[model samples]
Target: MKIHFSARTIAFALTSCLFIGACSDVLNSSKSEQLMTNPTEVNITSIDDLNALFDKYQYNDASWDKGNREVPRITFAGVDERWAEGSKSLPVEIKKMIFFRLMTPLALVSNENILREREIVKNSPLDAEKLKKIALKYDILENKTGNLDESMRTALLDRVDILPPSLALAQAAEESGWATSRFAQEGNAFFGQWDFSGNGMKPLNQREELGDYRVARFDSPLASVEAYMLNINSNSSYLKLRVLRSKLRAKDKAVTGIKLAGTLDNYSERGQDYIDGLRAMIRYNKLEQMDQAYLSDNKLIHLTTEK
Candidate 1:
């Protein structure tokens, strides 16, 4: 004989199950939106053009220590859940991402003078130790590969977060050798990332796949920088970054680009070294000013296909 449970017990169990199933959706709706889409931003030709847009932004790396710091700005791309495997070709829609530097802030880059300052740089090229010590001592470059230093941060107080601008500029300056690298100039790629498909050009001694593929190219450095930042903020590889970002919004706190850098495992397979590399670039070059650049207000395009 089958034992029957009381009606109250059965009803309670069903209600609990329904609540558990809906909890995730309820909590997500209550939380601040982690993903967004923006239409007004800089007009770009390819992902690489984002570098120029970022370089024009102003960063104040020195202010990271101050309390009540302004939150860094962002432009949501509204990337719909879309992916394709083994396509071997980038879609024409991607041109929109390259064409419009969406993440560019609506501000002026006034910190270009800081990078040229003598105190921020090491006296001798070989004195990397001093720089490292100073950077480490303050935790200024720990994870924020694109953060600013003490001097620059002082100028950015009350100006807005603008930290992403710093990260973007630092990444470009360090990777492209201050816009002098061949890949930066020709291909508009600053990250030195390889495209496994044979569609794009490769650097000298660079390995090539048996087939053609594409590396997200841009018409300007700013466009490239913008795309690179967006990639880190959205891609699955940067799960930590996304999680940390979500946490900030959940608690009604501003997201810190430098802090978010710690979550970047997929930024490089080298793990912690990759984080260090990005931080070193930001610290050494004083890229904190890049976060100040604004958008161009041109119609932006979005990517439709992926490999």
Candidate 2:
């Protein structure tokens, strides 16, 4: 029998699986006293220290395998106030590492799901029950219409597509100021994602014209990463990005961040300028290299949870 889970249930389960044991170990460590008081801050001294942590988990050298690459690690302690005080290079390095660690897995999972769904759709005769189940599972449609349509399929494809790492990292660095922005420090709001719901963190400078929208907050940097990806995937403004990615996938070409950056004109108020800036950042930082990186299966260095 095929199993199904609600979004909330799936989120809760994933969060629990990723953090429960990790948090417990952190709490039991020698630094537990300090961590209990400031849960968001972890003991990362320098970029070298962070790399050392990642090296422990890096089993394979992905230099040879172009197609089957994975990232060294996915967990990050997150940037704290100390990041702002650290060397200029430190913040940039931390931001880049954290961005890759977060985006790589999300992209991989989304790509895998999209590929699976496409295969299923291509082989099977349209079954309303199956299509409806998929549509509901992926949050493609908020309500079931009891009919499978081309629009629903398009929506599913769009929602299940991946965000290019270069675009994600550039936008993250720009929005969060290399993880030193107040929103990032306080609420793990890396993308400056706005939420009208009162559950989010109120922006200090929110203007009257901007309405009552507050920056969306998250329990961890990973959560912020997930939210950002989902925002791009599901939001109507980014439909062009999805369409572009689909074309690349059809031709078996790598979906690069530089190419996709052009379709992100709607991501910011600056419009075309924002897209240009994203492309510039990607090129300047050579972040396109990260598009090929993936996650490793080795043991991870877990950061303490944010309360």
Candidate 3:
């Protein structure tokens, strides 16, 4: 999965159509106007500092609505360096906070793309050029017939589906044990994603019946988050979740994580119990409030460093 181009180049290509300026202007304006503050960098030197930061950004104010204000983002540098030495609580809290901050931006980006595509589908005729663009963007077959059928519509919707922050947080917590699991600590595999290519960390107790699958390794936690979102958006297993999200969007309703949890029975071996646990985690921790969270105008980048 080596990307040939730099991140800046990819980002510029993605935004050039939406912005009204040269590449440098687009880059500078995004940083200066959209970003209200410098990126907050958190070096996890001690548990006390981490806890204090979480308390500072706690979303407990009843007046705060998902539609009203932007959610702030925080970055953690050298996140994997000190996790093994700390108490379980320290790593768990750190992982939870990281998940909260990371998923907000990803969801916001996905929702924005979904809205743009919906408008395109609603307003424009499905010309050859438009269909080709859609196919290229979503990895669909461009050689197909030009008709915009239900299958094409469903494909577009599924690719643009957004994952709920609460659902993502709960799964991360359950799969990685608050980022203390061996895969997460060693390979940045926050979701326990499996790679059958033998390029990841092997589970010590993987049963023989499960086939030869290793926990996917990532260069950083942010990479893991991106992969997780892509999995939900594009994988066939999560089509039910995408369908549920589409219905909610059609009704102009919010996509709550709890409602979407029922569709994720395929995500794990626990079946109904997994969904119940996710909903329970959401309710017990009041994670529903984060469903409406949006990234602040300020940008935050999570960076990883070598030990």
Best by TM-score: 2
Can you tell me which runs of candidate 2 are displaced by over 4 Å? 1-49, 57-69, 87-134, 137-139, 144-151, 303-307
Top lDDT: which candidate number? 2
For every candidate in turn, the CA RMSD to the true structure comes to 21.9, 11.6, 10.6
Residue 25, model 2, lDDT = 17
What overall lDDT, based on C-alpha atoms, would model 1 receive against the true structure? 0.38
Per lDDT, what order, best first? 2, 3, 1
Between the candidate structures 2 and 3, which one is better when assessed by lDDT?
A: 2
Candidate 3 per-residue lDDT over residues 230-294, each given as its tens digit: 77776678888888888888899988889999998889989999999999999987778767676
lDDT of candidate model 2 versus the reference? 0.60
lDDT of 1 by residue, 39-85 (tens): 22444332233333333332122332332123233332221111111
Which residue window of length 10 is worst by lDDT in model 3?
17-26
Q: How does each model score on lDDT?
A: 0.38, 0.60, 0.59
Candidate 1 versus the native: TM-score? 0.40
At residue 55, candidate 3 shows an lDDT of 44
